[model samples]
Target: MTKNERLFISPLPRYAYWLFLLGILISILLGLLFYRQVSAMVQHQAEAELKRLSASTSDQFQVYLQQTEYGMNQAATEQYIQTAIEKRDAEVLNQLLYGWQQNRNHAELWAILDKDARIISTLRGSSDNHNPLSLNGLALRAMASANPIVSTEIINKEELARVGRNVSDRLENHHLLKQEGVLTQLVIVPVLGKNGQVLGALCGGLVLNDNQELLRSLFGNSQAMHAVYQDKQCIAYFTNDNKVSFPEQISPAMTKSCILDGQACLGQMQSDGDTYVTVSRYIFNAQNQVIGYQVLALPQSQYSQLPAWVANISLLTGFLLAIFSIIVIGNTSRIRQLFDRERQRGQESYYLGMFAQKLQECTDENEVYLLLKKYLSRDLDVIQMEFNIISADDNCMESIRFTENDQVSRVYLNQSKCKPVLTGRINIYNDDRDLHCNQIDTDLIKSHVCIPFLAGGKVAGVVGLGSPQEQYWTPGRIEYLDAYLNLIGPTVTNIRLLKLLQAKAFEDQLTGLKNRHFLDQYLLEQLAIAERYKTTLSLLMADIDRFKLVNDNFGHDAGDLVLKEVAAVIRAAVRESDLVARYGGEEFVLVLPNTSTDEAVSLAERCRQAVNSLQVIHNDYSRIISVTISIGVASYPRDGNSLEALYKLADSALYLAKNQGRNQVRTAQEYLATLQRTGCDD
Candidate 1:
């Protein structure tokens, strides 16, 4: 044979070709396995992230509902609300409801319903011109359960009008109105009398269809899509750009699998020829019933592209290796570098996930800031960290700084440096000169970044991190910082909101004293303590004499002034250890621990004398009015053993004092003797 043919036909060369082909096949199989593993992992991570976002959105919705209910409850306890309901005054109800609705920006519509479930007045407009809003199912349920209710079932204008007409026509129909339409979520809370009787229901509506700002704030303004489904139909939808739109009546299979089943569903769906990985969760009402579904869609192209590229690169590398086996040995270091980069990325993700989990466990702003500082300083090698909390009440910035020496210092940031942050924008400083602040340590800090903590589309606070080295804040680090702030921002806002709600829950807004809720809780706790230690516990119940006359003569405004003055006097007369609460309309209760009935009588007398000496100048009438309060004193173990018994005895004594003229302090025994004398005279 010829020389060229002999070299080509050599068995050694043939074996090498077969080996090369086999190696190519093996590499293809390995690439397929790698692609599947990576794709599954990426999908899982994406789903988890989406679920977290959905959960956060759900929590924000709940908080909004809570705030609305709290505002309604506060309004329900207002003196004006009670007065308007008692006198059936629509004008007064409208004024009170409108003012309350304006004060609470979240309230869309405010209405006051009578005990018979008839709408007495609404802030929407005049009751004569606008038909009364019917008591919807949510309101009825809330009234029945004596708890707040949140419902997402939409009720349109026409249907509401029909229900209102039916309610008016029946006159005696006390059943809940059965109406559903396209309206939004409603939060209904019942207004209760002093004896815990449901006097009326207060309803606040949140129209979600046009509430783009709220949806964007809750779902995040990013490349993430969100939709709200009611009755398996898309009622509201938001795109990745935060634009509000409604999806047409097309039934999505995922809705049945996820919403109807009440389970979180994750899968891929094709829409408009583009693939998307969708995650759906059931949105529940305050009654713990599934009201609707919330769907989050992410483009599959975004995640799948990386894995596809990785697989192609593996295949190309395998082909090159088969062609040049010697080159593989030389490129080992390059392969190791790629592996190391991936490992670093994975570690960063793990750390971020861990930090987010820890952050969610924090319940206070200070704790959140401290946790952020610890993690940022340790993970990112930050030299100095500072957090500025924006006070919504005062419009001031309270700052906490952490130094390299592990020292924490609290300070205040000036208005100029905090303006940009308070404007809800991220400020990046490549050098210390960019930060025009006296608080910045220019000598120690070379670079820094400031990110705002946003909540409800507003800046709640700002977080800053500094490094001694130049160019230390990279793009990746900034992205991680953004993630951290996003998680902690809502948390801080929630904590502050909860704190405010807690204060409101126990306080009387009108009189600025503790309310009946606080009175009951504190009285029970003190009574338990008194019983355990065999200590004396005295109770005093005081009522304004002829309070209705003050309201009827001088108007409700004057009555409010009198109540405020009485509360102030009562608070002044008692010691700091004593507990004073506005029990109800024209009534105040005091719990005196370790005190006898004599001490209680003296305190009550002092309070009455202070009120009698005061000249309450009404701002509205520009007239002075004299006020007198009747008091009744009862001591634990002497008058009664239980709180209910003691309260009843004190109340009876107060009634007796009111009956025998007015303006005097009487003990439980004194009133009983007066009753006996009256019986003998009869």
Candidate 2:
């Protein structure tokens, strides 16, 4: 409540009609006292009738003004309108204004006005000027305040010409216009920017003197004439007969009050020996001061028709309210439905965004397929996903599928059998009998979609999605599936390439065993574990006996074959926990964890015996080649507790084994005992 309402209304007013004079709760109790006062003026019923008509006419004017303001506000907030204004697109702006006028209302002259009141663009209406029109002062208040303005005033001849209406002389033929200036109503509604700045205003004008459209709608068949006044001076008059005289303007003073005090006025007037009743309504500008007034007159003889006219108005009002209520209720339900759809769309967008982010973190080809499987299952009741393994050497593709239970299955098919892969497009199958992919079962899925994904400029995988209802595969869902498939294909390819590069970096190309670099990394980890647990760890260094003679006689290719055979035999002889790597050419090293020196020596002999049974033929199988390996074993924490010490002791053991015989296994303890005995003999 306002301050005045609390002081005068809430404190002391329960049923006091005097509060009506204060305009408190006027929207609810408007015209209440005026209807009560009409009884006192029954003797002069023409005045009361005039008040009824004037009040009705003023209500219509308020409605029209409010509607124009609302329409302009809607235009101001339109996406296309705002874009056009921000871009200075005059052509699109003018077309939009024209369309709005055609669809909404055309009584007002419409123009898009800049901050300075100059025409930015306008719908081609009454004004036919080659140049733009500008409202000199009518729009100034609205633009400055960033609010709507509605006022009625006499526009001078010079201002009308600037606004592209130079028809002052043409109006000399009408008797009322010859003596009085034109009354024009200007409505200015400001357009706001994104940050609440006033970008411009929409200036709409209704030329009251130009036509009888406004007055005809209000008093077309009524026995009345409406005259406009500014500062009590006659300006314009409207009558169905189009023959109102200037003498009607001079015959009345305010009967109750002038509009300057924010009160309605009733006056008596005499023109041509006839008594007329007049009522005036206030017209305000931006500052809320009365700038003009409207005087509606009714002949005293026609006062008897007042009662029937009021009854008709009351009936029409009730019917309109009933229709408006239904429209409001229906619109409320529609708004809820629209909100639900928007919320669902937002959720789908969020999930797709997460899917894109997860794709970046996958480092293995199988991980990429699993990620794809997870995404499909999130939004579908039943889903199917598969990958095509392309073997370029065999020149064939194999379709592999992992079921929900994660059982792997493969089916071989021609590359051209799947439509998506053959045509590089999406295959949409909706029935069981349709030609579908070999990996995706059409019988299981009532609705299915499949698309091929590319890697290295070639089709690498085919993705399929299934749903029970056809509506689930909307255009948006289909597009998302295609986009994600294309996304995962590249990711899987990159992971496979990285795996291949890692294998090449750590594995020996000739012997197919982990290389020396790989051993160095694994040895540190095993040694740390041994030191923590106080367990035995041994290193065995082995050399092929007479390996140089084999390579020198049978070329380097035969040597590589022999080395590969011997490395395989050693790998088969050791435990799974042991690591064997190519130490160098003609030599191999094994790092055995949790093994004693004696256990390592036994493992080395088993490998040596396995190699003794192996034979490699070279040069068209004409010559047979046999080789033996001499193995040396050293235990950690028994040989100086360091990698260098272990390696030095192992090398000395291997030299002793070679000095004794080529095919044998020796421990560092045996070698040290022999060295001490020989020294004592010396």
Which has the greatest TM-score?
1
TM-score of 2: 0.44
Q: Write the per-residue lDDT of candidate 1 for residues 31-59, one digit (tens) a residue.
A: 66655664566555555555655555565
Residue 360 lDDT (model 2):
60
Measured over all alpha carbons after superposition, the RMSD of each candidate to the real structure, in angstroms, is 10.0, 28.0
lDDT of each: 0.69, 0.66
Error of 1 at 112 (Å): 18
| Residues 1-682 of candidate 2: C-alpha lDDT, one tens digit per residue | 8887778754546656565434443422333333334433443444444455576567546555555565566567654565556656677666655554543342445677665566677554332324434343657677778778777666665555444333454455644453344566777788888888877777766666535556665445445687666555565577755444435244445445453245568766766677766677876654566656777776655443224343333344433333433443454455446445544644554565566567666656666777778877777676556666664333777767787676678877777676777788877766655635556566566677777777656777677666665445667777657656755654555555444445655788888999887888788888889999999899999999999998899988899889988998899999998999998988889999999987888898899899999988877999788999898889987864877788888888898899998799998888889979888531
Error of 1 at 632 (Å): 1.5
Model 2 pairs whose backbones collide: none
lDDT at position 522, candidate 2:
88
